[model samples]
Target chain A: MLNRPASDTQITHARRLWLYAVAVLVMAFLILPTFVVIPMSFSDSRFLRFPPQGFSLRWYESYLTSPEWMQATWVSLKVAVLTTLLATPLGIAASYGLHVSRVPFSRVLTIALISPLIIPIIILGVGIFYLYVRLGVVNTIPGLVMAHTILAIPFVVVTVSSGLQQYDSNQELAARNLGASRWTAFRTITLPQIRGSIVAGGLFAFITSFDEVVIALFISGGQNTTLTRRMFTGLRDEIDPTIAAISSLLIVLSVIMLLILVLSNRQK
Target chain B: MSKLSVRSQPIAIRDVTKTYGSFNALENVTLDIAAGEFLTLLGPSGSGKTTLLMVLAGFTRATSGHVLVGSQDMTRVPPHKRDFGMVFQNYALFPHMNVFGNVAYPLRLRRVSRSEIDTRVARALDLVQLSHLAERPIDALSGGQRQRIALARAIVFEPRVLLMDEPLSALDKNLREQMQIEIRNLHENLGITTVYVTHDQREALTMSDQVVVIDAGRISQKGAPREIYERPANAFVADFIGESTLLPVQAGADGFAFGGRALRATVAPPGGLFLVARPEKMELHRTDMDPAYNLFEGTLHQLVYQGETVLAQVALPEGQTISMRLTSRREVMAALPEPGKPITLALHPEDTVIVPERGQ
Candidate 1:
């Protein structure tokens, strides 16, 4: 390409510019909805449509004042926290077992652990809804947390396992030979080395549970409705401009949390 | 140095063997390491030196036989319970800890008080001369500094036994040599019973009071460095320990004849013998003046110049080669022997070691 004459340089530059412009257009196509919703949310119009004549913060104030929204937000946050606590340990155990087992069927075990991610979320939600109802735990915080943990565990395993791969096994053996018990060696040496992976996995798990909607739709009764479930209700039944406002707020919150997670990982 | 408080354990491995499936990682290897002695398990790669060290450290269990640390049977003991200090090949410094924290780790595990921990860690750092860098994070230090920290950490607890598995292998050549001397000095000062493992023959000879040469999952020979180098038991030891030129000789009752000349030697000459001649012991001359010695006429095949010595590879009259060393290339020029010209190579009677041929 560099061998081309100066006369053809203009043609080559034009071609590259055309390609970049096309890429920009494609990115705008994908991000257009997210950008359109922010302004539509602030519109004073009652309908959930763009190009409003007036702008106001009435919907934001309504969302802030409503007990239902506040309760659902609190429920989502609690479920995310609980799901992270459960899934991170369980995923670390599963990944460790897979890595250190040296068993013939260890690959099969790993695949089984990650199978939830392979399945469609709707199918899992339907099955879990029936299971929760039979177990008499539907619409309860524990039931929601359990379902979310099941969904979040695979991400945790992948992240933590990748982190463990960077660690040196000899360091642990060195600790053990230096008079540390196996558990103590793991606690002091192995855990600190992979702390970043655990944090990253926990962040993924928390984000997974916070935004989960299909399972919440089935299991969350009015008393235990999560923020996602309420947004779904507003979308389906009312098509309220409030739903757009909630979605815009959720997008902002997710961006902030994800930014923090990414920045923390970079620091590590 | 003060006497070590912990009683030195006599490490004994009796008929110990470890097998990973069909591969015999270690066979019925047995030896006793005296307390407070610097013993090295020396061998090339896959020769079971590291495996034996692991067995002694209790990181690995023998498939059969018992490992005794003094009177206590250590076969079933776990690694942590063995309380052995180990320096690994990579130096294994905790990346999360500073130099002080790293040295303090063993004491922390022992539940020593905070003030005692501080004092002991300071002393250990001082032992390696890294006291000023105690607060610096381990990753910030150079390779040699980190290794010194590893050594300090290993001996901070004053454990009864220290195990080092090629701990200096990762450093540059000059740095490795320097560390070898430093570690030897530390061992002499502390008198901690130590087992060091390395494949580098020079390292084994330099640091070990007694060297155990291993091959094919067994101990081939064991003795002091001078003894092992001077009188290697077999062809393996002679070749492995240093550069040796083995010449085929037809033996008579009094002496061995090579290239139609009866060579003078002190060692008994069997019917057929292999003479192990070290390069430095062989002399080269243009004239056959040393006819009384074991002199063989040869052509100069090659000349190699090391910084301190010049090695001359001579092609003998019997279609064989012998290497002789000189202090300078000027010596070779003084002899006035061309590369293709013929000359005589002579070995002193005491320099030629004779061994009977087996499994010929």
Candidate 2:
């Protein structure tokens, strides 16, 4: 009898240990490539390698000093920031409207807004490229911004809608009954409560626009080439280590944006 | 903060009806709330009391009706323009704001001066006795404190009419009782026309100057608290207001007859009727008690001890039962008989009310 209870406890402990081991392995597998890129960026050789024979900062210097790389980086930054500004408010408005509309077909509208995420990115890229070429707006900054905005809007809508779901709309009604106008109630009461979600949605929009390459490759070129498009060409045309350096920088930028999103969420 | 002049306006609801598809939430309801009067709408769940309150607040539109605030037609007006203060069921305080900020929101909407907002908010908090916690975050306060904050916010602007929808329903028994007294006192001091909604019958009887009983989208009865409790209009009101035994009776040549025995009543119904017997107004007797009282011989079935009083269930002839409440005094407890023992009970004829049988 003693042996039976002892073996049962031992079995439970062993099962837990095995479960933790599998979880650690899964996590490591997911994050291993991200960590591998950091060391490869600092490799002295022109080609990507692991366990580098030597270390140097030539790739970083090349990415920083080259005018073509600098222009691409600037273009990407501008588009991401503008996309964030344009999409956050629009998404918040759409979410609030859908929540209060009580229309019979609101579910259909929500599915339509989220369709961009489900549709193949290449098909969307080709379709938009054709439209932009016909309008003579190809290779323009405005065209790039418009394409990126469309891709980022779904993320904003989804995040803002979930945030609004946790909100008590009765607070808005209470404000209105106390003599505040409808717009004033929304601005003062509802907006501040959901500020964290709005900030998180804007960050997601920025990241989506920044990382977008498929649409950028199809529509953007010459003076307004996005960083991702340039990186794609650099990989295809030349075996430049500068791409690794840019990848490392992009990874760091994403971590910083995610950290801001987490901190804003904690504040709420 | 000094006392400021605040005008009160009477509300007139005329033939209000609200329907959703084929179901009616409210049907042809008309009520007039006098200026500075405290009125309560009492009903069970889904009885349309809350719908009536929402209509007055302009949150829910009526299918066909006219709502007038004083001399103005407020039927088509939006809620924000109606300028009525409302306390929600959940207290609905903004979680992002402090006590002072929440209480000062309505004042800020009117573009009041900054210094004036501070003074008025402080005074409102003082009225609710939470002046010391004016700077506290909303999450830090207890449920009762949040309710008080909601009350202070609703009254800070001193709107013409104040509406409350089950504001104390979330509180525990003791706190709810305490808040009811505090709210009634506040209403007396402010003298603002107020409309309150609650399903608790005791709360309605305690806090209302006028109690309106609503049932199934219609007004069952409307009167003072005493009139509603002592003289309920029908079987529904009597069964709803308090514990009572409603016995079917028939009109005899001399008086009313229940189970072929003559029973005296203060009021006579035209056709079928029910004799409403309040538990507390009943007395238990052994020998001849009084000739003026209506007497019924029965067997004692059970005695339910309820702290200070005992509920005695008496089984009469023909399988009918009536409950009598006796105080837990020494003499009363000693005189109580065992279960299945024969006993006689006396009920005053004046305490027996004859209300018409429903649907006839």
Candidate 3:
């Protein structure tokens, strides 16, 4: 039967069915955990359990009303926003500089910039923690923002660099030939063409800073405790179900960000 | 339509040379472009024609030379400060902007009023006959339409000098021919000093008032299209400009000798020589008809029947094949001998040019 020739209709049907099966399996593996967590967040049990005896908003109420969870959420938000603002422009400048300058060590510079992504998160966390202690910036908002920006910048550089790659440098030359200054050419021609990549990079930076926990656990403490660190502590020490509520909310935020990226990519 | 004011300026390139590490992209080139003249830099790929045009546009800096516009030295001037308009090979239209927005960009950069920008952009579009699609997105336009948009955008600012680098190479042959006329007409109306670069010899011949033949980082010759075609300076220029068979010639005190016979020539060469015979200038003769014509007997090796013309390849005694193009008249085709038949073709002494071969 495998050696027999098949009609076009049968072949298409079989191929599509195989692809559908693989897609369904992949989606389940990706999304099933988030779906389970959402239901467990609404459970009326004292401990984490699926298919609870009843459903209630008790964990969500605890998460909203408790000062510790609220403070952690505020810290995460502040650090992520600050990191996006600082990293996006710096990343764009660095990518454009590397692209146009044709520097001798550009490949080495790119590897250096993206090294954080390749290095182990534990090693990066330990290194940053040591550096933070020396600088006397541990547990501070600026310190946390600085660490998040460092992680976020690589994403910006990578995304913007790919965007710049797709952009034709001749557009900038055309603008300059038409009597526009170099800065104006970049602003009016090059930037607008790659605006989608800039937006995607900024969103990725926000998500990276928001979801980061390894570096936060090492250097963040006291009043500047991040939400992920708080959630870790809650799971390890207290076994609170409010951690489930925060996890569900974080999942929803990440899903929304990913949806925006998909829509922007489709627009391009 | 109100005629836009475009001041034409003469360009002077003085011994410009550009070297990239060890490779020389342009080597010690000097030329002068007259005001309101359309000059074309024609050469094969990697022949430095585009590099010379880039130096003129101020996009590429010459290693050591001077560039002057009218009387002002602009060797160090940046591209933007030079205020020239350029059409790139790929059109380079902004995908984010509509057609009008792309064309109006330069005027806006010059701080022209919004109303003036709209008027000028519309007029430019009208000149290119693209006024109907002013608001269309660039992605929606065809390749020919995109080229027109690029042309409109480049000239919309009324720049004193206009540079085009193989602008029509992306279009099909028919469109390219039509746009060549349109650009020539536009140049006549606008009178901007234009420098065009292309590898297409026919395009250079059709559109340029003066054509500069470039070869391997240097200029071989610079003259009018007819002059370059009729009287090439050397074997390289002769072979480059048109289809020609350059036969090696022996130079002596009397004249040049080719194919073991004394051939008549207008000018004598010093050392190594070549007889440049353009295919179109050759005619098949029953015998030596004119005393002023030099004759050659060869075998009819191949006959190609084009619709309007027949290309016949004749193998000379020295194992060199010379192609001759004849109008496909009934009598001409009938009188032509078959393949492997002996044929006699004649070349006028005036049409045959003896040029000194370069590098011996």
Pick the DockQ winner: 3
Worst 10 residues of 1 chain B by lDDT: B1-10
Model 2 over residues B175-289: C-alpha lDDT tens digits?
9999999999989888889999999999999999999999989888899999899887788888898999888888878888887878877766666478887889889865666
- Tens-place lDDT per residue, model 1, B155-262, is 988887899999988899999999999999988878888999999999999999999989878888899998778766666777788998778888666677776778
What class would a CAPRI assessor give candidate 3's docking?
Answer: high
User: Among these predicted structures, which one has the highest lDDT?
Assistant: 3
Interface C-alpha RMSD, model 3: 0.9
lDDT minimum window of 10 residues, candidate 2 chain A: A1-10
Chain B TM-score of every predicted model: 0.90, 0.95, 0.96
The per-prediction i-RMS, to one decimal, reads 0.8, 0.8, 0.9
Error of 1 at A161 (Å): 1.9
TM-score of chain B of 3: 0.96
DockQ of each: 0.75, 0.81, 0.84
DockQ of 3: 0.84
Q: After aligning candidate 2 to the native by TM-score, how far in Å is the CA of B301 from where it should be? A: 2.1
The fnat score for candidate 3 comes to: 0.95
At residue B154, candidate 3 shows an lDDT of 90
In the predicted model 2, the residue pairs found to clash are none
Encode model 3's per-residue lDDT on B1-360: one tens digit a residue.
887779999999999999999999988889999999999999999999999988988889999999999999999999998888899999988888999999999898899999999899999999899999999999999999999999899999888789999999999999999999999999999999999999999999999999999998888889999998998888888888789988989876778898778998765566647888778888988553777788889999999999999999999998899989999999998989999999989888888788866421
For candidate 3, list the clashing residue pairs, or say none: none
Best by TM-score: 3
Local accuracy by lDDT, each model:
0.85, 0.90, 0.90
